[model samples]
Target: MTADTSVRFREFKMPDVGEGLTEAEILSWYVKPGDTVTDGQVVCEVETAKAAVELPIPYDGVVHELRFGEGTTVDVGTSIITIDVAPGSGPAEEPAAAEPPAASVPTPTAPAEEAEEKPKGRQPVLVGYGVAESSTKRRPRKQAAPSPEQSAAAAIQAEMNGHGAAPAAPQDRTRPLAKPPVRKLAKDLGIDLATVTPTGPDGIITREDVHAAAAPAPAPAAEAVPAPAPAPEAALVTAGARETRVPIKGVRKATAAAMVGSAFTAPHVTEFVTVDVTRTMKLVEELKADKDMAGLRVNPLLLIAKALLVAIRRNPEVNAAWDEAAQEIVLKHYVNLGIAAATPRGLIVPNIKDAQDKTLPELASALGDLVATAREGKTTPAAMQGGTVTITNVGVFGVDTGTPILNPGESAILAVGAIKLQPWVHKGKIKPRQVTTLALSFDHRLVDGELGSKVLADIAAVLEQPKRLITWA
Candidate 1:
């Protein structure tokens, strides 16, 4: 075979590993050009806003080309890799294959528009045979053959001396081209897409461009501006010997945006309580020995989570959200308890759905699975949605307490602080007891001081007397 033998090239578009996620950063490639790969081999790892996932090749093939490099954020449905399915037996080439382009292929436009017409059965999926009808996928909605008014005018003009009416000009010159995810980000940040300058491959407004637009143009030396998520840092730390600027992306970016929105939009009120949790700590040990709880994760966090659930049952009004659009206070009948976990990437709150329905042992098992999945960087975006309340255990970091910020949309969040043996008044006597601080932050718009205080007090009461879990629950 000739060295220049050509074969069929299959382009693999970036899959939406997380449902509806528009873009992902190409972390690394496992195979280079000409490398042999099996059908199920993982070709690359990409980080979506929710989590990092390994993408596997769907068929046996030889790597042909990589369209994007590491650290580049590519939109879903955009080709990221190409493969040669028939390596040795060269396929017939196009008649004009000998000719080359004058320059690089025109940077592709955002594919989100035409994708709306595609049926779900035909679109590319994570782990299956993708119907490879990609060549005709970019078809635009055909305009009904030119209106009759134009045809009549064309006949009159042809009679006057013109052969036919001049073709109508293309109608899409003014629309700003942006992927769906970028557009969603713009909407969330209250940015006008057309006003933002384009820095993407083909005049497409990217997520970064939208963030920059939010910050606005730079000012003179005397003035500075506070930028939003995924934008450059306002101030740099220059004191260190070696400075490394890591561009914020993925989970960290989403967390920053949520925190900023929650901080500014919600009316926050916090209350703190210090309590003796010695009996609760002792119960943890006892549960560990129970055969029903054997092999499950029995830790301080497990009990804390159960206590918060019990409190929610006692004070149901605290488990609610403020809906700005409908201008209503939405109370949740079920609890999706969010656990704020610190991982290598950043802070992610993956909540347990219908947590109130679980038994103590079941909750412990679920908690173990959630933490393990998070630590492995495998938490799906679905696991992080629809949380009714949250518990942030800052105790693991040895901090006393904090005015914890309420998770966006949720009315309340409980911050569990470090547990220490401190001198306390136990039954009218000073004694060393296992004591801890609990801070509860709530949305004042929905949860008043009385309701927030009741919820926090209930949790503290349950910890003080472990028997309350049976009565209150």
Candidate 2:
């Protein structure tokens, strides 16, 4: 029942951006110490295991401190920024021991064993956060005595100082000034910012400082550390020049894991069909000029999406997920149709919810918006969730067909290959026609070979004879 007399500061702890995600790396900070922040203002951007999210400050205050620099991975419920809320307070006069502002809700009484409460002034969290355990509670640390090596170093330093040798004054170890890119480089290399010797003007930490810290430590006593003998012309090490390494994280990491799980867990059966889409191509041009579809995206993908939707309606079993835990097939009545879009970060399939209910124009609009958002790296986690079926157009890349893997959880994914004018027999005569190959890969556990073949055939039939869409719908 005692009142908190410490400096009033609101500690903005990291939230669970996605279900059960424990940590996120700070991408960039929009606010720094001495900057004023308002309620619901985006203070920083963070990249979680799933997606990049902008965290909004929940209350109005002046930023007292940024607990961790950009690129640091902070755990959920851990304070990342402290903001002073008192009317006259400022970052310039921030208290040495600025505690988090306590909650107005009273601490409930509990048994003696559970009486120890969490540290006061902890940031409020959503219900998804796991209950704090004993290990989560901060404990005081007792300093350990120096070891023999450290004692010897101290003696040597004292002897040198007694002889008028200048002592190295401890450098300021407050927040280090570095760009986010430089900080990320340091983090990736496992270099500690505090240990790095800065050479940049204004004492700011630079990318060179971080990389220099990661360089091999100098050899002690050239005599003791013998250099390796030079390699002969036959034993060269130029393999590194031809190879490149990229850190797999974010979308790439998630996609890799999902694809591996899907490939091994699901019994995949892919069926390929080559179709003449000359009629479908003509329809695409017609729809583009239609007033109803004006300002809406009109493309083969849109009609292909509609065709798939119709096929799903005819064979609802194709739009299902294999629930391994439940030992059942979950047939989704509503389709969240995912379109695989490849971005610089990686490939992501963001779906349009209840796509079956959307008319051609509406579906086109949603697809256009989804693609644009994904290209700009602004797609939300919700947009990528609960996908029932997916379409991947490898055709755009000028590649002929590919046996595309089924997206995780989804029963089927259709890959559209490049459409080219190829000689084909029409009405018993060889003529140049728009031809493309479509490959539909599905999980055999949920979709049988007969069902997968029917779905693939349905899509091809609809594309070959565009009038089937009107008749089928």
Residues 1-473, model 1: lDDT tens digits: 53343336666778988768899987656554445567888887788887778899986776655666445688887777767676655532321244332233222222223222332222221222322322222234346786889888877877677555554543332335565446546644546565679997657678889888877542211101111223334433233326445578898998899899999999899999999999999999999999999899999889889889999988889899888899888889999999998987789999999999999989999999999999877787889889889999999889999999988889999999999999999999999999999999999888889999999999999999989999877
List ranges where model 2 is wrong by over 4 Å.
1-7, 90-244
Which lDDT values do the candidates have, in the order given?
0.74, 0.74
What value of lDDT does candidate 1 attain over all alpha carbons? 0.74
Report model 1's TM-score to 2 decimal places: 0.67
Give one digit per residue, the lDDT tens place, for model 2 in 123-172.
32211222221222212233598898987788788787684334466344
Candidate 1's C-alpha runs over 4 A off are 1-7, 36-41, 91-242
Q: List the residue pairs that clash in candidate 2.
A: none
TM-score of each: 0.67, 0.71
For model 2, the run of ten residues with the poorest summed lDDT: 218-227
lDDT, residue 352, model 1? 96
Q: In candidate 1, how many Å is residue 351 off?
A: 1.0
